[model samples]
Target: MIKIAIADDNSFLIKTAQEKLSFFDLAVKLIAVDGKDLIDKLEINHNIDLILMDIEMPEMNGIEATNFIKNKYPHIKILMLTVFDNDENIFNAIKAGADGYLLKEINPKDLHQGILETLNGGAAMHPSIAFKTLKLLRNPQDFENRECQEEIKLSTREIEVLEQLSKGLNYNTIADNLILSPSTVRKHIENIYAKLQVHNKLEAVQKAKSNNLI
Candidate 1:
């Protein structure tokens, strides 16, 4: 039997997915409340073949969880089963290594077909999402910029600090230029690094410049 795990924050949605899959000859191995809950349960029982992941969840989001699961359990297939079909969500889910993307409103027969297609090394994407994916592939730079804008949102102070840092200014010099304390400058730098997902000053400046953040 094809063992499956469903991860959705809403209990009603989880039940709905369960009912949809009930028509198939698959087994519902577990139903998790959210991304973090799914990871925890998988630690104990990860014998499932696939996971129906929701995008927005408490503790950890689906994209983050999918990245982690793909890294740790590369054998398991992840199908993003979410209501959100936005460009950012779709691009991020694909980048996180989801095997398929299906809308929550999909009928049982199509849902079952999607699951099987995903297991058989074929992507099961909604037609609209498939069109977006093709556009993304055609113009990756545009999608990359869009994805960067969505993920990295910096405050004005953070931008100012990054600008100073880009000019080879130390924390104290940045504080002097911005008329803020050295500690405050340091805090702003920390926030910038976190938002930009960078380690040091050089990487932060490079990322900020590439994304047009500063």
Candidate 2:
């Protein structure tokens, strides 16, 4: 039986998921109200087969938690279940090692199929999100394949900063949001611009967007 755990803020969601999975012949081992709870459970028992994680939660959101789990337990599979359809959340979750993403509004049958696909080592994305992910992965601009793009070299943190900036956030806001010192935010921005060969924020953001760097 697949041993699954769910981490979500809504009790209704937890109950609903439990009910839906009750007939699947799988074991629902744990339910978490937040990322921290999920982490604690994993620390005590690392036998989880799959995790359904919500994007937004109290203390350490799912993206961070998923990254941590993937690093610590590379064999486990994570499927993101969230209400958000935003590109930023989708990209970040994918970057953080999610194996699949299914919107909360997905029908129970589709959700079940998604779980099976994820377990079989295939990515399952909500139809709405799959389009964006494909665009980023397949059709990155400059009309060049991303792997062949020799001009772009950005560190992971710098890419994070650039992603935040592309969302129209300023350095101070990015600093506060990422819990980085303001000076550190500035330094990342400088590095991003230098890597992208852009002189100003507008140009940097435009180039990044055009090239799908963020």
Candidate 3:
């Protein structure tokens, strides 16, 4: 089995990811609540093959963790599984030596395939993320521009998800109201984050309202 470590603060997300991973020959060897927790656990057991890293975590963020890990354990591959897909985050993750970057919305089969591909020395990226990666490469200087010129577009469903998130509703609750699966709600939220260039619900909500998208 491919030994993997998951670094996410949300237990529900962790459980959901675990359930999807169960379909493959992957073993979740360790679970860390955040970047700091992941670092602490690696001190005890550093024999894992790959890490499913979340970007936004308390104590230490994923970029910091990835930098430290790649520096200390260069042999171990770090694949970023995150909700944020903004230009700066993608640029920073690549700069920090992440082996691959994938969004949280990816399906189980694709995620498993990505893990296998990353283990085999290939970079794994969600298709949309792959396009962004190419754009980042072509215009590295664009990283300096924090403000995106493109219009902020939130789909009808995404706006609904954002509106629900603004009310401090959890994923399952939002899923129920929207008549979407929890996973689908999660995907919509991820899209919202990427579009708004925000990491969390509060930021997403604030940006959406400021842009009059909600």
Candidate 4:
């Protein structure tokens, strides 16, 4: 049986992946919740044949894991199984040395076939993903616009928090002004940072301003 590794933050998704591979001659040898976890596990047991990697997670993401694994364990195959089918994610995963790109919605048979094809050195991809890849290649200019054109959804409260953040207001002051507790304000800011995909106050504010979210 081929040894398989699954890297995803959600336990449900991990279990689903295992169920999909249940009937095949593949064994789920290891499971990791994030990219850092996957790397640490691989350090102990590098015998995994293929890894089903998810793109978004808490500590580290699949693209980063794929890059690191490709550098350290060139023989191991990585198939990105994610829900994100955006142009940026697709190209980034490809550049990170992912052997295949399949959405999480794939059925059992297709997922198995994708895995087998990837193990055989084939670049398996979802049909929609393949079409998008061709379109990206044909119109390279679309890559930049596709990312920016997508609307960044934020709650009304999140936007208010962002606006307060942009004014250089401290968490306490913002909370007082908005009639919220300090810890609630802090949580709102955390959500804002996550939604904007920014780390610091400056970055979050700047991204919100750039995207016109604030």
Candidate 5:
């Protein structure tokens, strides 16, 4: 039986992870509310083989916990399970020694595959996140200087698409509002992510706002 642990602040997310793990017939040894709790639990029960860690938590974040865990328990693998896929967070997690990174929206099959891959001494990353990791490796200096100082250029339609995204609207809704096809809206979003150098909608909106582009 593969021993696993989950650490997340949200009870709902914790339950969701538990449900997904149940499908694989693996043993869930521990469920921690936050990073600190995870460390404390490991003190008593350090027999876990893997940990599904959440990035944002109260007391201590996943990155800090990963650093601590790796130093004390090098044998245990940690896979980051989070919603935020921004470059900064991803870079920090890798630097802190996370074995793998997967978004929370992953289905059960992929999550299981990711866990297995990590245990087999392989890194698992979402395709988009893998692309960003390659980008970071290609230009380490760019990641070090992530703050956008120069003006960013975005087309007028892209700005409109971003505005709708900021309002928490889905692609279909945004397409309907802009009177564009779903494929066109998706293309606009892809362009926005590339132009802003962000990986997700939240990051794109925040970057655009900070740069005074939207």
Candidate 6:
């Protein structure tokens, strides 16, 4: 049986995840309330193969926790199951070493499949996020690539906005930093999103990173 651990702040979510996981008949070895508890469990049980982690919590967030896990137990696969779609969070999670990224709204069957696939040396992402990943890849203009006469035109201000966004800044923060009204910032972001054909920040940043735009 594949040994798996779950870390989430919500007791209901923990129980729900445990129930969903039980259908697969894999060993549900541990459940942690926060990042610290998760790490503590990892200390005692080194055989866990996969972890379903939540991004937000009291003691420590999932990003920091994932980083610690990857440093100490590089072999353990982690699948992020959180509500946060912030580009910075997603990129940081990827950098810190998450095998897959899934949302909390995922169906139990898919969640089980994601776990099995991760354990079997494959990566998985939510379908919504996956779509964004594709759009980001096709944007040659975003990254520095020559030999293209036809390119999506982006104003300097728009580029500036996208660059900050690619760095993981939220709309409000980006607006404040740029000294623009929140509405103006939102408009610029909307234009960028439309030009890039991406739905969310994570997708936009992923595309930018792959192109070395940020």
Candidate 6 local lDDT, residue 96? 84
lDDT of 5 by residue, 1-214 (tens): 9999999999999999999999996889999999999999999989999999999999999999999999999999999999999998899999999999999999999999999999999999999999999998899777665545454678899999999999999999999999999999999999999988899999998888777777
lDDT of 3: 0.90
Task: Spell out the clash pairs found in candidate 3.
Answer: none
User: Each model's TM-score, in the order given?
Assistant: 0.72, 0.66, 0.68, 0.68, 0.69, 0.63
lDDT: which is higher, 4 or 5?
A: 5
lDDT of 6 by residue, 54-158 (tens): 999989889899999999999999999998875546666876899989998888899989998898898889987666545544653442342211255667898
lDDT of 5: 0.93
- Candidate lDDT scores, in order, read 0.92, 0.86, 0.90, 0.91, 0.93, 0.82
Q: For model 1, give the RMSD to the true fold.
A: 5.2
Model 3: per-residue lDDT, tens digit, 78-151?
99999999877888899999999998888999999999999999999988878999998998855544334246
Q: Which residue pairs in candidate 1 have backbone atoms (N, alpha carbon, C) closer than 3 angstroms, thus clashing?
A: none
On the 0 to 100 scale, the lDDT of residue 19 in model 5 is 93
Task: Give the per-residue Cα lDDT of candidate 1 at 12.
Answer: 94
- What is candidate 1's lDDT per residue for 1-214, written digit by digit as tens? 9999999889999999999999989999998888889999999988989999999999999999999999999999999999999888988899999999999999999999999999999999999999999998789899878777778888888888899999998888888999999999988888888888889999999989988888
Among residues 3 or more apart in sequence or in different chains, the pairs in candidate 5 whose N, CA or C atoms overlap within 3 Å are none
Which is the leading candidate under TM-score? 1
Q: Residue 178 of model 2: what lDDT? A: 90
In candidate 6, stretches whose alpha carbon ends up further than 4 angstroms from where it belongs are 134-214
Model 3 error, position 154 (Å): 30
Decoy 3 TM-score against native: 0.68
- TM-score of candidate 4 to 2 decimals: 0.68
